[model samples]
Target: MQLLYACVNVCVFLGGLAEEVDEKVLHAAFIPFGDITDIQIPLDYETEKHRGFAFIEFELAEVND
Candidate 1:
């Protein structure tokens, strides 16, 4: 079977985050690194709050530097 993967830029995985952290906080904290394309924070269904982690996607792979 051929596996197809989507093209993605530099992505950062952050764990052990506080539930209070949100997209805005992440954007502000990471913007100095590079242009951020997206931020995803998974939430707990019961509390409707963040799951103590997030994914940050940068516009360019160079952000890995």
Candidate 2:
């Protein structure tokens, strides 16, 4: 069985403006992590900019091993 773990502390670059960052970009960046099961990028309600980071859920704990 594969043990799942959540990966955090992803660094995202703001494209020109802070508001340019979106979920789609975050998902694409993390796509290479084959064990990733899901991703969530939160945005500021007023600024609509990425919080500068995201939470990635990995399907396996030993992915980096």
Candidate 3:
């Protein structure tokens, strides 16, 4: 079986203030997922900050479950 898993990590600078988080912070949070094949974090070019979410791809279904 072929399976793909996507995960998102959000960081709130002031807790409940999602707008205050940075892209770097979000990226750092995702580091522990382990064996991630692909990662994408959309950000605002003007501010160069995280959109408060991320997308990660894992090739193995069993690893996620």
Choose the strongest candidate by TM-score.
Answer: 1
Off by over 4 Å in 1: 1-7, 61-65
Per-residue lDDT of model 3, residues 1-65, tens digit only: 75333344332222332775554565566557554555555666898875656555544545454
**Model 2 alpha-carbon miss at residue 30, Å:** 2.7
lDDT per prediction?
0.83, 0.56, 0.52
| TM-score of every candidate | 0.78, 0.46, 0.41
| Steric overlap count per candidate | 0, 0, 0
Candidate 3: where are CA atoms >4 Å away? 1-34, 61-65
lDDT of model 1, residue 49:
87
Tens-digit lDDT string for candidate 1 (1-65): 86322338888888999767889999999999998988888778898888888889889754353
- lDDT for model 1 comes to 0.83
